[model samples]
Target: MESFKSILSAKGPSLFLLPTWMEQNEYLTAGFTSRNGGVSEEPWASLNVGLHVGDQDADVVRNRQLIAEAIDWPFEAWTCGEQVHGSDVFAVTEVERGMGRLSRASAIADTDALITNVPGVLLASFYADCVPLYFYDPEHQAVALAHAGWKGTVQQIAIRTIEAMEKQYGSKPEQIRCAIGPSIDDCCYEVDGFVIDKLQPLVQELANLVNSVPESMLTLVENGKAMVNLKQINRHIMLKAGILPIHIELSEWCTGCSSDQFFSHRKEGGKTGRMASWIGIRER
Candidate 1:
């Protein structure tokens, strides 16, 4: 079964929820938002939750609030980071619980991944086509959200997040459950030589770790370009980081292919809305 199950209604935020995770842990909530049922205008028409995407601040906040309401999370707990496509992982603390909820300036700076053992601090990251990597260390009641574009993927953001969880929360990698959310799949994500070159070393390392072939992560096309599988590469990276394969959930929804259901920066030619991936444990 597809791990990210869609929950749609007539007039609310459309969501793809991780039912198994939420069901297994009563206090936990994890899912990705869709581009429908919001208040933005064209290009970013409807549900665009990104505050920095040139959308009206009020509209964007309202959209975010709609998601928070739908998920039954307080909007004040919606914490986020200013994604720079880097490998830096920040452990969100209680004092920083609501940073970036209303504005970008208040958001955690220079980070692509946010991890927290702090219950009630919802870790959110925006994405259009970039992969959204999720980590849950049930042993520590901690969760994380990572934004992985090609740059962050090459830099091994997933590994960085695992390390952060281990160091900050005493989370064992073997106990961390991971999920790759909706994003541009290999069929829709074509890359040039520059990206391929950056990925070559890691691709080789992934093969060695999983005893898999290069094509499992990168398929070379013609004219110095190739189709790259960010999700699979990140999965291999998670395996290399000591996460069990059975504990990981991978989404099949491709943003680039399903523009109606998602906002694809690549398919939409860069003027697009952003969906959010969130994981939080309700304060008890």
Candidate 2:
């Protein structure tokens, strides 16, 4: 895995990514988005791209347009899916274009991950509290994006995404670079005894549980909710699959903490809009 930096650009209040990435000859590049810029106003603020948050339909469309321009796209060509916090990941292709729109389709039907190698095809996963994970294999010119909340993380969606990459592109876990985008960090995440009770026994029994932190200080013998570090758990999953420790990039920004910059379902609740994490390659 090579080191790559995602450059940030501000267009109005919306934030966009620059054109820089490490990839294969067939063309595989990607970037995560920051919650700045766009057309929505007030509660949704300036650039809300999520339609499920009760923002105006036209505002969301205009916001996507501006964000697309920020990335220098003539028009945003994106493929989205219903994120169910399950392990299903759709392969983006020219055949299906109507799978994940909140107007026609909500981001909450099924499938929490997306993998694609199609150029000019952007795979965007929506989330406010759920972790958005990304995968890039320079060896296979393939990429994948995942939306993992506690349920998804517990199910090891990251590992499954890698498994999909290997099956689809022959990508080795060691050769893949995983990026854990901004989400609700431990500082802003809290769980109860029930959560710890369910997780402690499982993690403690793992052959690769390098470190264990619960949602609380409950002893493994006693049920206590420990503040599970989601980012660490995702990295652990990658390492468990043989991905290099150094190959993982954890975005230090916490959406709950940076709610000023990003949306947070935990902080904003049902009324808040979602932020999107996307990645794409140029096929031409």
Candidate 3:
């Protein structure tokens, strides 16, 4: 079996590889499993964590169990959201823990962001082409996991999430470690007119900074006017929000192009299964 010991030791929040230390019971470790690891059939084959994707519930449960076991934890401690694609962020508190999907309804609703200070409380959010933003504040022992698609991205979900962490847990951006997980990269992520127009205004200056045409036109630019690196844009949002660029780690892997490794909705035309990302501080 391929191991992630070296990958984890290398340091950076955007690890495709899981760390033994992080899995060792009391560390603020975070990792996302690729579509590469488990046991299922075609379409949902190998390590598919998404439940509603037509993969049998038994297979989904078994797959999730393998994923959780690989991460060195029981599936029960893991908390996941229904993922409505909005910018709502939730605080995983004592009352909310154990009351959510591992058993019943989530403590919150219509949310895409999850924050928790309760160790052993693993919070998960789903994504395919959408970006997964994982936030860990060691100072406050709090962590947040968010799923940001184009809509959520334009809405400034990253900034809003950082703001929420500060408002509720007294977390400062400087002390936070943020990782932007695997998603459709700039090169392969092409969009349409409506999206560009809606995003252009909100990301005017920000887009200008990342979406440069400087004497060159990009085919992917909607209406042949603007092109963008959504990952960089989200990174910029975090930077402006006070997250250090050095502290922010991004996976160079693009879901759209890396079809064998990840499940991309665009690459597969909406027939793809989703991937889950999470972070937690152990109670022990």
- True lDDT of residue 104, candidate 2: 31
How high is each candidate's TM-score?
A: 0.99, 0.84, 0.84
Q: Which scores higher on TM-score, 1 or 3?
A: 1
**Candidate 2: Cα lDDT at 268:** 81
> lDDT tens string, model 3, 41-135?
77876567777677766776676666666667767777776677788888778666643444224435678898877778878777788998988
Best by TM-score: 1
Worst 10 residues of 1 by lDDT: 49-58
Residue lDDT tens for model 2, 1-284: 21324444454535423233433343444555556666677787766777767889888867766655665654436667766668876766665433444353643257788887666776777878788888888767778899888778778888889998888779999998888877787777777777765655545543235454433322333234456667767777777778897778777777889876787878886667677776777667
* CA error at residue 15 for candidate 3, angstroms: 8.4
- In candidate 3 the C-alpha lDDT for residue 183 amounts to 81
**Residues 96-201, model 1: lDDT tens digits:** 9999989999999999999999889998999999999999988899999999999999899999999999999999988999999999999999999988999989
Scored by lDDT, model 3 comes in at 0.71
